[model samples]
Target: MKSYTIEEINAILKGELIGHTTEKIVGPEELEKAQANHITFIGSSTYAKLWAKSKASAAIVNETLSVEPGDDRALIKVKNADLAMAKILELYNPPKPHFDIDIHPTAVIHASASIGKGCIVGANCYVGKDVVLEKEVVLYPNVCVFDETIIGEATVVWSGTVIRERCIIGSNCIFHTNVSIGADGFGYRPSDDGRGLTKIPQIGNVVIGHYVEIGANSCVDRAKFSATIIGDGCKIDNLVQIAHNSVMGRSCIMAGHSGLAGSVTLGDGVIIGGSASIKDHTTIHSGATVGAGSGVMNNVAAGQTVLGYPAQEAREMLKQWVAMRRLAKK
Candidate 1:
């Protein structure tokens, strides 16, 4: 574990410091468990009492705290305690991998694939024909990118992930383990004899925007016509399924096990909770929030929070829950 002196930390945080400036701060900990060598945080006034009893040698507090004369541990006062904690964590962050050799010898690249400078293609990775991998892109072992796929700069695709043909991946995007991008959408029509289903050919691809992160095993299916789009800064949790022709606006978040059916349109900053299911052709306006396990069948207004099955407004849903509990007393 790395250590920083009280004075050294004060210099880094650039905040007002109180108490002894020589105690060696090793790592961060919660207020209750923090030792003399650990740094703790007080984000609210409610935690002030807890801080007084905490064993931490150093603490980060927000602007609301005042200097206490009796308790004299090293305190760093800042505008936001949370942001300060993030900076402190960066100081102890693990080292990144060094890619001295750009492409591993075991990797297979087709004749027409174009790999940019400083890119790292790991062992057993497959790059298909006419694929374009931009500078500093990293593909971990067993990753596959099909023909004509264009991966932007500094994108990282982890092991066992697949990006199918003609998909466009933007810069600084992360596709975690076993993610499936541009797979065929679930589309079928009844056969001529009405005995079986006929598959609809998914001719379109997926287009991902910059700084997006898709969690492990999540899948974004290809479009039946144009692209199935994931907008910039969107964060998708594990086991999320985005079906054909679904278009999400920037910074939208979909929690674990969430499903968006084909042709769903989500506006900017829409937040879908865990296990929520949106029906086909539904539109969720900007800044709307869908509660966990919700079933959305109709269009949602801007900035609304919908909850429960056959989703209704959150406040109304809570009232219904209260009424149900009252009736259950009988």
Candidate 2:
């Protein structure tokens, strides 16, 4: 366990000390799990009460909470205890090194491809013809970058991620394991014989903007002509399906298991809860929050919060529900 004195921790975190600054802390643990010489945190008064009985050497506490120091424990007050904990973790956590930059002997790089400096291409990875990978890109084992794909600087693609032909990923993006970008959209047309399905060729690619995070096992499908675009800072959770021609605005959060059909547009700062579905050609404006399990059919305006199947305004849904119950009682 890494140890730091209370005074040392205060200086490192720039936190205010409420008790003895000479105490030594060995590591961090949850309040319930903390042992002697460990520092813990209480984000709320309920946890503060629990912390009073803890055997921890020190506790990070919110400023508004009243803490009576026990003989064995001291309090370090901060504006936000959780944020302080995050900062401390960031400071003390060891850095993860990028894999050494070398193409494995088993990997295939086309002669026409361009790989920039400090890029690591792992075993069985494929860099297709005309592909361009910028500086500091790391591809874990068995990644496949298809033809003409463009990956920008400082991108880290975990193992088994497949970038289909012509996909364009911007700088500082992270693709977790098993992510598939620029795959064919779920588009099909009825056959002339009316007996079979005709696959529509997805000729376009997906454009992923800077600082985007695509979670593991998620898929972003390619468009027919235009691109499916995920804007800068958008965070897409695992198992998400972004269909053809969909446009997600900056900083939108699309939670796990959510799906957007073709041509859907989400404005900046939209928050989509888990398992939500946005139908084709729908639009959701800025700051709107779509609750979990929602099926959004129509458009949602800025700052609106909607819920339920064929999602309606949250407050209106509650009011209607209450009225229905009252009538049922009658």
Candidate 3:
């Protein structure tokens, strides 16, 4: 375990130290479990009250907190204690992965593929013909990179993930287990004979921008013609689906089981709550939020929060609920 003196920690967090700057901190721990030599934070009022009794040698707190007189524990006051603690935790971050052999012996790499320095290709991972993997890319077991696909620098793809042909993944992205990028979109036409459905081939690819994180079991389907784009800093939760031709802007977030149908567009910072579903070809403007389990069948304007089936503004939906309750009592 690594250790830092309270003085060093204070310098790192840029916090005002109230007392005993020389106490040693070994690690960060939960408030209930923290003891001497461990650093913790009080990010909420509930936790703030508990701070007086916590066994931790020091705490990260806001400047507004009042330190009781005669308490021996040191206090580091910052503007946002939670954010400060995040930085403090990063100080002891584990080293990035490195291996003696860049490519695992069990991994298959095509001769035509271009792999940059510091790449780690794990067992059973396939690098198809003409694939390009930039520096420090880590492909965990059973990751399959299809032909002509490109993965940018410092990207880590976990086990059982597939990147289909011609897809582009940008730098510092993370694809969790079982993520499927560039899968054929669901498109079909009724057969002339009225007996079967004819498939429409998905001819395009998926473009994942920098700093994207797609959680386990999520899928981004390939566009019918142009690229399906996931903008920079977007976070897609587990079991989410981004359908054909959907374009998401920077920092958009989709919670678990949320889905966007064909041709849907999301502007910057749009948030889709858990189990929300957007109708096909819908446009959700910047900073809009869709409430949990809502079915959005129309466009959501910029900075709006929508809720309920055939989703409406949150306040309107609440008023409807109030009216419904009054009618039920009658």
Candidate 4:
């Protein structure tokens, strides 16, 4: 086990120490589970109130909170206790899985495919004709890169991911397990004979920017005629669905189970909460936030926050909810 002295830990956090201690802290733990050698964090008043009952020898406290070190306990005061705890956790994080810089014998690579220096193609992986894997790219087992696909440098694709033909993936991106990129859009029309539905041809590709991380089982569909674009720094959570021709700006965050209908446009820094569904052709402007479980039916202006089904302004929805509750009491 790794250990750090009180002074050494304070130096790492750059915090002001209140009361002095000579003991070493073994690791971090929650307030309810901390022991004498463990450290904990008090980020809000709720956690701060529990400090007196905790057995932790030391704690990282928010600078704005009024918490005193009792007896032999020490307090390291910082601007944000949660952020400080993240730094401390990094100190004790375990090593990640290592991949050797070689292609597995079980993997198949087309004669025309280009594999860059230091790339790793794991077992059962497939690289098709005219495919390009840039330097240091790592593809885990069973990943499929179709013909003419371009994967940028240093990108890591996990198991069971599929990049369809002619798709463009940017550098340093992470595609988690079972992710499906460039799948055909769900477009259909009535058949001329009035017997069955006719499928619309989807011939476009998916273009992802750098530093984006998509969670497990997410699907980003190909466009009808152009590219489905995902901007840099966008973080998409697990089980999400992004339809065809949707354009997302930089730093957009989509929580788990959120979905975007066809041709939906989102501006920079937009946040979509879990299970929220945006209507087709709707535009959500910069910094707009959609509440969890909301069904948006119209465009949202920049910096607005919408809530509830058929989502409206948050304040309006709250007012309606209050009135309904009062009416029920009568």
Question: Which lDDT tens digits does candidate 2 get at residues 124-215?
Answer: 99999999999988888899999999999999999899999999999999999999999898889999999999999888889999999999
Over 166-255, each residue of candidate 4 has an lDDT whose tens digit, in order, gives 999999999999999999999999999999999999999999999999999999999998999999999999999999999999999999
TM-score for each predicted model, relative to the true structure? 0.91, 0.90, 0.91, 0.94
- Candidate 1 backbone collisions, by pair: none
lDDT of 3 by residue, 168-240 (tens): 9999999999999999999999999999999999999999999999999999999999999999999999999
Instruction: Indicate which candidate wins on TM-score.
Output: 4
TM-score, prediction 3: 0.91
Q: What RMSD does each model have against the real structure?
A: 2.3, 2.4, 2.2, 1.8
Name the lDDT of candidate 4.
0.96
| Candidate 2, superposed: residue stretches over 4 Å from native | 21-27, 92-101, 322-330
lDDT of 1 at 167: 99
Ranking of candidates on TM-score, top first: 4, 3, 1, 2
TM-score of 2: 0.90
Q: Flag regions of model 3 displaced more than 4 Å.
A: 21-23, 65-70, 95-98, 325-330
Worst ten in a row by lDDT for model 2:
92-101
Q: Which ten residues in a row have the lowest lDDT in candidate 1?
A: 65-74
For 31-91, candidate 1 gives per-residue lDDT tens digits of 9998888888889888877877888888888978874523447888889999999989888
